[model samples]
Target: MSENNKIAKELVEAVGGKENIASVAHCATRLRIMVVDKDKIDQPKVESVDKVKGAFYNSGQYQVIFGTGTVNRIYEEVTKLGLESSTKDELKKEAGKSGNWFQRAIRTFGDVFVPIIPALVATGLFMGVRGLVMQEQILGLFGLSPADISDNFLLFTEILTDTAFIFLPALVAWSTFRVFGGNPIIGLVLGLMLVSPALPNAWAVAGGDVTPIMFMGFIPVVGYQGSVLPAFIAGIVGAKLEKWIRKRVPEALDLILTPFLTLLIMSTLALFVIGPIFHSLEEVILNVTVSVLSWPLGLSGLLIGALNQVIVVTGVHHVFNLLEIQLLERFGNNPYNAIITCSVAAQGGAALAVGLKTKSKKLKALALPSSFSAFLGITEPAIFGVNLRYMKPFIMGLIGGGAGGFLASIFGLKASGMAITVIPGTLLFLNGQILLYILVNLVAIAVAFVLTWMFGYSDKQLEQTNEA
Candidate 1:
């Protein structure tokens, strides 16, 4: 058999043969399998299989990390073995049946927020570039002052940088509705209403430049530009309300009355009830997050950085999306991104150390490429493939992350965006913080590399793992 075919066969046996697999699917970097019985699988053998970078049980699925292109080939081979084929979305539903209530909630948040990350990343990059070009030093190099810059050009930059945040509610609501099984277009319209031109701007109200409109002479109302929680909650309510109304409305009127009643009731409740209550709660959450990140001597950063990867292992790190959104909305920068970047970079460093120190060619090949992947901001390969496989390396990485995060806190390092981190994270720091960002990541890598090289790896352990 070919090498891929061999690996695929071995993987099937390792996971208790094809009979134990309920369904199989592949994403960009991992072969995700829903297994019939977890207790029947041979976990160690699965990890030791040739060309298999790593394997782990998560979200009720046995996810085998085979790196990017390799997974597709292996997945094809696995399917050739008479396994049932499935899509990633279907696999997600299968896995979704296993997590606890909290995990499900966190996953829901992830489902909603993850789709919106690309727009935010693009907007952040635009903001960074605009800020870079508008710098006094940069302008001086062009023999021009701020006054010499064209108003139309500045207006263009504003459109690129501000549009995403100004319509952030719409994005959140649309995603939430999609996740909750409601019509996304209806959600989009509801979100737009929250930020309608007739409403007082939220930022303007905060700045005391505009007064909020009063509903019933008591409830102050303003636009939800840059708001997340209100939009998310409103989306959930509106979707459920629409479903409820749809079930009751007569078939003849279902097309018209359902949407009309849903919109009318939801709009009133969102403005008068959900918006006011949830926005206050969002502010409270934002305040608490700020307080934690602002703790004395960077203790909060140290703890967060040290534990960030640990959280990732549990598959609940998506919960951070709320904190990140809050930070960006409140301060226009994200320190959490800087701190977590250190944690991610540290994983790369530990994996790199193992790759350099290992006598096993299989491990060296896996570790080296996975480590590089970590540097580019995707850490699953490095974490599962190398660092966690060797416990000492994982702990050393945590320490390195903590050390780098301490420095990040002391320096007050913040990124202009979220979603992207590590090397690609440089874009978020382009607004005059590039040097500090590099310094923090380098420190994380160096600390993890030195510690793991000195003590984390051993040929003896590799021999044992292979023997298993």
Candidate 2:
């Protein structure tokens, strides 16, 4: 009977009901989907639904965007129909349990860290281009080796990059408020108040050292600046609060009253509790990760190595990203870089191994190019076409990745930046026998190829490789 529940049902129906969908998952701005058949999907119907903006297909899934929490509702609706919300490719996973440790880890990493990627990529490319462009631009006005060019560039880069996080409270408010069904502006306003640098640096305040909040608390809407969790929480809370206020206020002036009360209550709650709690949670996650990685480098490396292959197969490799990224943010560097570097190298090796082992000219060709891609930091081809479809190569890849990851971890090597691909990915770590790490990865590939060559091959591949 509630407006929210009614809207949720209507939204689900708009997406073509239970029969039309095969599975679903969600990311920051999109709902990754699988339909019984793509043609059966009623794209027009779904798009027509309120709050539904657009939909598209990518990487073999039909994705719908209804903001943030929208995915949860649709997911709930799909489960009500008893159909799972996962891809056939991800069929190895169970339904609700898809929220397992791996899934949670991956989702957290992919969601939190992905937002920074576009800006970081832009900044890196900017720095790269500036090196080439600075002198040219400087020639227009001043002289060579212009004053503060590099310094200003670095400062600009830091400001732009840090701004994304520094103003994160408002940013989070905007996204999350939209998700939770509140007027997004309210959350944004709340975020601005909290993150505005003018506030007396409230977040760092200690128990006895200073007051929780200074003059800002005296205002009607308390600021939450730089805080993400509370703004995120407020969006949901504000939406709910707005809904309740809606019923009590006369319809004649409902809109104004709803937002006013909603923003006031949500911001108040956010300042007092939500922000601090989430910040603490982030700390806890950070501490746990550091402790585990530091406990025994060798074992951690071994675990990443052995499991990384399986995680990749399940598209669960993202599961480890949170540990990696969060630690980098909190502690300034991560030990997992070595393992990841080796894993990538192992990908190239696996593809090469599969190519060498296969007799099917088609598979060999696929494997060869895929190996090149993996070496360059792409792994889908090897994963789907060679390793997964053919079991032996996949197993060999696991053995290789596990061994390489373990070795790399023990080496205590680290990477300063995120490696997007394999080519330069090879450049990720240069400390501590980096060459030896390279050798280890190549050796894994060779062993995989030799093992698969000796024991496994389809007759087609056997004839093809033999004839070649």
Candidate 3:
């Protein structure tokens, strides 16, 4: 058999053979398996399987980390063994059945926001580039100042940097509707209506440059340009309304009448009710978040950075998606991204130290790649495969993260983006904050590495692991 085939067979045996697997699927980095009985699997043996970086039980599924590209190959091999193949969406539904109401709600929010991140990341990169090229110092070298640049060129840059955020509500609404099982096209239309050109621009109204149109002589109505909660709630309500109308309408008129009624009712409710109420609620949430992050003496950064990896272990870290989105929407910069990068970078550092110090070749092999993965902002392999397996290293990483976060807050470092972090996150800092970003991440890594090297790893621990 080929190497992936061999690993696939070993993995199947490790998880209690083919009979115990109810279904199998793969995401970007994991081979997710829904099992007949969680108790039947040998956790250690699964981790020991060659080419498997780590394994964890999460959301009622056994997720084996194989990194990108590798998981697809192994997944194909696993399916060849007669196990039922499944989609990631199907696995999500099965896993959703096990979580509590809060977990389910958070997962739903994650589902709604995750698909919209790539557009934001691209926009952030464009913003960073625009900032770089428009710098007074850089423009001076080229015999140009801000006024020397062409208006058309400036307009083009604005288009690149501003379009995604200007239409953010539409993206959120579209994703939310898709997640809630409505017609995505209808969702797109409804979302477009939220930011229609006919309405006064939200940013302009906020700046007192324009007045909002009054719906009933008292209720002010403006476009939702960078809004999140309002659009998200509208999507949920609109999707449900569409589904309900579809069931009641006659089969002959279902296509035309259902959409017409759904859009009409949802549009009125969204503008007069959901939009106004949720927008206020979103502002309150933004205020609370800002207050927490602005705590005296960098306490907020220290706590969040130290605890972020711990939260990741609980499988609920997706909740940060909303906070980061809100921060980017309201402030146009995200300090939370800078703080979390420290926590993530520290994981890699601890894993690197363990990899270098470990006497066991098996562990050294696992730790090195896992550490590299952590530096690139995906920490699961480092956290589960290396650092957490050696408990002291994980704690050392937390300390390192806290130290870096404290400094980040003191420096007032922030990113122009969200979703991406650690090394690749440099793009978000290119707008004049790159130096501080580098310094903070280096501090985090150095502290974790030095601490872990001194006290966290030894051959004795390997012996204990083998014995267990």
Candidate 4:
């Protein structure tokens, strides 16, 4: 038998046979299973299975980490064992059952933001490359002046860098519509209308280069380029309106009228009503975030860095995307990314300490990769699979993150963009502050490592260390 098949068989037995599983699915690094009876599973045996880095029950599913490529193979084999499988949508429905209203709202925020993150990340990387090529030191090495770069080439680069944020409303609206069970195409149309060329550009209007259109001789309207709240509010209104219309319209006219009316009404509302109110609200949020960042003594940084990971654990952290986007739009830089990167790195450091100190083979296997994942700016593995399980390591990470963030704020560290961190994040700081970025990360890691090694793990837990 193939190794994957062999492991699949063992895993099924470990979870008390195929009958115990209601459904199963896999994401990039984990197999998520919803079991019919938790009592039937042998948790120790599951951890001991080969190729399993770690396993934990969270959000109502048993998530078993098998790394990137390995998860697909294991998932294929598990399905062949006659265990029922679920689509991602089905899995989401099952997982959604566990959280409270607040928790569910947070998960929904995560759902909306996560889909759009890849576009943002790619754009950030593109900006990094542009910044790198524009550097005077690099250009001088090639005997080139800043003017040596052609205007056409610069314009092309700007297009690549600007496309994502320029149409961010469409992406946000599409994702939100999907979440709220509306036709995503209609959502896209409504979003596009919010930024139509007929309206003055949001930035142009703000810069006084163009005047805003007066609506009903009282309200002002402009394009929602780089705006967050308008698209989000429009999406919810559109989706709920679409659902309501679908219920009342005849089945024969449902497809045409529902979509047409939804788009028509939503576009009008978004441009005149929802857009103005939420744009003002978004501005308020942006100002509040800036004021907090500017607070005395790095106090804001210390507080945000300590509490950020805790928010991440609750999955509500994606809401900060609004603030980050606004910060980048107004000031052309983001200190928030720098502050949060410290917190993410601290979690990795704490996990690494646990890996080094633990005698349990199962735990060591879990901690090492979880730590590496955390450093790469994905902390769910480290947070849920290792640090939180050991309680003390999680707290140590919080302390270390706060210290690192305080220093970062004091040094005035800032990033050119959002959504990338630690190693991949180095690209964002290549504008002459790379050394400071490295130092901040090192401080976070070292502090967390020392704290975890000193007080995070217990000798008693070590004494109880058998492989499983």
TM-score, one value per model: 0.97, 0.61, 0.97, 0.92
Please write out the lDDT profile of model 2 over residues 48-88, one tens digit for every residue: 44444345543446666544466566556555556566643
Tell me the tens digit of each residue's lDDT in model 3 across 75-155: 999999999998999998888888688878877887888899899888877877887888898899999898999999999
lDDT (C-alpha, whole model) for all candidates: 0.90, 0.58, 0.90, 0.87
Residue 329 lDDT in candidate 2: 43
Please give the ranking of all candidate structures by TM-score, highest first, separated by commas. Answer: 1, 3, 4, 2
Pick out the ten consecutive residues of candidate 4 with the lowest summed lDDT.
459-468
Residue-wise C-alpha lDDT for candidate 4, range 134-202, written one tens digit per residue? 999999999997989999999999898888888989988998998888989888888888778888999
lDDT of candidate 4 at residue 401, scale 0 to 100: 93
Candidate 2 Cα deviation (angstroms), residue 387: 1.1
Alpha-carbon runs more than 4 Å astray in model 4: 1-19, 37-48, 359-362, 465-468
Give the backbone clash total of model 1. 0
- Candidate 4, lDDT over the whole model: 0.87
Ranking by lDDT: 1, 3, 4, 2
RMSD (Å) per prediction: 1.4, 11.8, 1.5, 2.3
lDDT tens per residue, model 1, 269-356:
8888999999999999899999999999999889988999999999899988888877887788999999999999999999999999
* Model 4 steric clash total: 0
Q: 127 in model 4: Cα distance from truth in Å?
A: 1.6
